[model samples]
Target: VDVMHAAFPNKVPYEIVYDRVVPSMPEKYKPLSRREFLARVMTTLLVPEEKWCLGETKLFLKAGSSLELEDLIALPDEEYGEALFKHLDLAEKKMAAAKSIILAMQAFVYRARFLRVRRGARTIQRIWKAIKLRRVWRAAAERLLEERRGRLAPKRE
Candidate 1:
């Protein structure tokens, strides 16, 4: 309502006799009527025609149109700047939190993968060591058996 009043600085109170009779008198002609003023304001604001209706006594707006109009009214420049800065700050904080969470998850996955690979490598090393030890032991046992057999047959010589 304050916005509407501000749009029409020279608006006059509607009077039936003055409105009907004064227009016919050339000297009393008003260039813009209330309805015409409202139309011009709505057009300038780019408000959709369907969103508003001009009634005899009052202007009617569709649901949510008034809120849209209110939003169209500019805030103080300082307040607007402050609001924008606050919103940006909040968004930055949220992004930072999300980044931290993602990094932690990545670290956990990397550590788990490293441990799994290390365990597999250690198992392979243990198996290889056991195989080498068994081969060496078997070779030593065979050499000892050959020696014993030779000694047992030496008496014939």
Candidate 2:
């Protein structure tokens, strides 16, 4: 695990990512081995709203604590689909916040783009500020969800 961590620094999990994702493989998806690599990618891409400082990609490494998403992840199969849908709704709400921020910044930029040069400059500055904020918030949340999704995934790889 340390070897893999040394190689993949910011992307490696708590040395147990392989352990957890491995045992959860449902019978149908038991053919995966090295496929655990995908889990790391998913963690980087999917988790959002986790604990992160601005521009931080590796929350665990930065926090100096082992982060476990499996503890917070719950998979509601067909029998629990209702709860799953509710969780999806919650996710939508979170996305809406980010979307609105981006949209508002776009509007400001668009309106100023062809006006006065000073206005355009200010707009561009604001746009950059908004983008930085978005990156921080979005990446943090994405990291959270992706890290947590290990067990909630299809279980069969």
Best candidate (score: lDDT): 1
Question: For candidate 1, lDDT tens digit of each residue in 51-157?
Answer: 67665655666656655334433445444334433443465577799999999999999999999999999999999999999999999999999899988877663
Tens digits of lDDT, candidate 2, 25-136: 4443345443333333234334432432211223233332224333222433332333323444465576898899999999999877757787879999999999999999
Off by over 4 Å in 1: 1-74, 155-157
**Residue 93 in model 2: lDDT:** 70
Which residue pairs in model 1 clash with each other?
none
Instruction: Please list the C-alpha lDDT of all candidates, in the order they appear.
Output: 0.58, 0.48
Candidate that scores best on TM-score: 1
Off by over 4 Å in 2: 1-68, 72-84, 117-157
